[model samples]
Target: MTKTAEAGAAPARGARAVPRSVWALGFVSMFMDISSEMVHALLPIYMVAVLGTSVLAVGLIEGIAEATASIVKVFSGALSDRIGKRKLLAVVGYGLGALTKPVFPLAGALEWLVGARFVDRIGKGIRGAPRDALVADVTPPALRGAAYGLRQTLDTIGAFTGPLLAMGLMWWTANNYRLVFWLAVIPAFVAVAVLVFCVREPTLPAAARPPKLPLRRSELVRLGAPYWRVVGIGLVFTLARFSEAFLILRAEPAGLAPMWAPAVLVVMGLAYALSAYPAGVLSDRRPRLDVLLVGLALLVAADLVLAFAPGLVGLGVGVALWGLHMGFTQGLFNALIADSAPAELRGTAFGVFHLLTGLALLLASVIAGALWDAVGFQGTFVCGAVLAALTAAGLLVLRRKA
Candidate 1:
C-alpha cells in the first residue's frame, strides 16, 4: 500500500492501535537509550570523581556535545527532505553511535572521552530529525500525540533501565566504571540491528516530496508562522531546562555515594516513563496548551523543591517532579510541531526546532554551571524556577490573546 493510504488506514480499534512501524521505532529508540543512559548515568560522576573535571567543565562538555548534535540535525533533516528518504540516514546515525560505544571503555584520557562524546552526539544529530519525521510519516494525525508519547514512554523505560543496570553493575563490580561502559556496548548494537530489520520507511508521494533545495530561503519561508511560534516556545522551554547532569551533581552534595548516583536518573526516568503516555493521551483529548501549562507548573514546583527542600529526600522529590514535567512536555512539543508544520517540511521543522532549542540549552547549561560554581546549587535551581515562571506567564498571555 502507498504510504499515505497505509497511514490513513487506522485499525478499527481506534488510537489504541499505533502503527507497527511506530512501535518498532519506539523499541529502536528504547534500546539505544538504554545503551546511552547506562553510560550517561555514570558519566557525570565519573568526570568529577575519577577524571577530576570541574563542574564548569562538565557543563561545557555536556552543552557542547548536545549543541553539536543539534547543529548537525539541520543539515541531516534538510537532506532527508531533499532526498525524500529518512531511514538510510537513521541507519547511518545509529550505526555510528553503536560504533562509538567502545571508545568510552577504551579511552584513558578526558580528551578521548570528549572526542567520543562529540562523535556520538553527531550520530544523534544525524538521526534525530529523520527518525522523528519518520514517526510523523507513518502515524495518522489524530493519533500523533499518542504515538509520540508512546515512543517517549518506551524510550524513557530504557532511560531508567539503563541506570538500574548501571547501579547494579557498579555494586557488582565494586564500582568498576570501565566494565559498565564495556557492557553498555551490547544494547547499542542491538538497537542498530532492530532499526535495520524491523523498521520500514514510508514512501512519500511525489507531490508530498519537498523542493530540490529544502533549506533554501524561499522553501523555508513556506513553513509559516505557526511553526515558528512553536519553535519560539521550544526555545524558551530549553532555556528554562538545562542539562540533567546537574541532577546527579545535586545528589552528591546531598550525601549520595558515587556508586548509588545513577539512582537519581532511575527515579526521574520512572516518573517520566510512567507519565509520558498518559500525558500524551491527555493532550489528544484536551487542549495541548493546558497540558503544557501543567508541565510548566511541575517544573516550577520541582525547582522550588530542589532549591530549598534539603537532603536526599528533597533531591528525590525534585528529580521525580522534573521527570514528570519532562513527560508532560517533550512529546507534546513534537506533536505541536507536527500539527503546525507543512507535511513536507516536517523534517526541516524538527531540525530547526532542535537547533534553536539546543543553542538555548547550551546557554542555559553554561549559565547553570557558572551559577553552581559562583553561588551554589540553590542559585542554579532558583534561576531555573524563575525562567519557568516567566515562560509560563508568557504562554498564558499568548493563550488569552488567542
Candidate 2:
C-alpha cells in the first residue's frame, strides 16, 4: 500500500485500544520523567542557593544540555534507520540515563553537576527520536494523535508526581535536596527495567530497510514540503517557549518558599496531564493547524499573565495556562511530524525537526536569561509574549497561504 493509503487505513485496534508497546513505552517515559523531575524540580534552587550559581548560569546549563541532546538526536535517529536496531539503541539510551541518576546526589562541584546533566541529556537525545519513530512504526497513523497524547499524558503524570514527591521529601528530610536526589534513583531504574523487559520491538524484513544514511540530500528530499512546513512551525513554537526554570523563578517573587518551589511544576504538570489526551483527540478530529493556533493562544495568554501578575494567584493562573499550552501543542506536534513524514524516514524527520527546535530553544533561553539579568523577570516573559504573538500571526498568514 502507498504510504498515504496505509496511514489512512482503519486502525488495527479499536479507537480505545493502543498497542502494548506504546503503553510500555509510555510507562517507561513516565518512570524516567518521574526520576528526572525529582531532580529538575529542585535543580534550579540547588544551583542558585546551594551551589551559588547565577540565574544566567542555570539557563545556560539547561540550554546547553538540551541543545546537546538535540544535536545527538540527528545522529542517533539516522543510526537507528541504518542499523534497523531501534530497540537496542533505546535500551542503551535508557541505561545511560539510569546510570546518571546517582551523579545528582553525589556531586560536590558545579563541573560534576554539569557533567552529569550533559551525559543524562545525551541519553535522552539518543532515545528520543528512535522511540518516537517506534511509536509511529507500531501504531496505525489514524491513531497517531491519541497515541502520542496518551504517552505525553502518562509522562506528565510522572512529571508532576515527581515534584510532589520531591516536595514531600523536602519536608520530610528538612529540605535535604541531596537526599531527595538519592531517592530519585529508584524510579530511573524502574524505567530501564520496564523498557528492557516489557517493550518488544516490531520486526522489519531486511529488504524493507533503507540502504543509505537518512540525512543524505537525496533522502531528505523525499521528506518534501509538508514536512518542512511542520519543521518551520516547530521552530517558531520553540522560540516562543523557554525553559521552565524561569517559571520557578517567577514564583519566588510571590513568596513561594524554596522548598515549596516545585509546586509550580506540580501545577503545570497537573494541567498538562489532564489536558494532553483531550487535545490530542481534538487534533485528530479537527484541523491540526487550528489546534496549533489554540495552543499558541494559550501560550500568549500565559506569557501575558506571568508578565503582569503580582501574586500567587496570578502565577498559578499563568503556570496552569503554560501547562495547558504544552498539553495542547507538544503531542500534536509529534503527531503532525508523523503525519507529514514517510514511514521509512520518520526517525530522521523527528531528528531534524528536533534539531531546529533545539537550536531555537537555546536561543530563546539565552535571551530570557539575559533579559532576566538586565530588565527583570517581567521583561523576560513580556518578550516571550511578543514573540508568541508574532509567531502566531505568521502561522495564521501561512495557514491562509496554504
Cα RMSD of all models vs. native, in order, equals 1.4, 2.1
Q: Which stretches of model 1 miss by more than 4 angstroms?
A: 1-5, 10-15
Which digits, one per residue and each the tens of the lDDT, describe model 2 over residues 348-372? 8888888889989999999999999
- Quickly count the clashes in candidate 1: 0
How well does each candidate superpose onto the true structure, as a TM-score?
A: 0.98, 0.97
The top-ranked prediction according to TM-score is 1
Cα-lDDT of candidate 2: 0.89
Candidate 1 clashing pairs, residues 3+ apart or interchain:
none
- The prediction achieving the highest lDDT against the true structure is 1
Model 2 TM-score (2 dp): 0.97
178, model 2: CA deviation in Å? 1.2
> Which run of 10 residues does model 2 get worst, by summed lDDT?
1-10
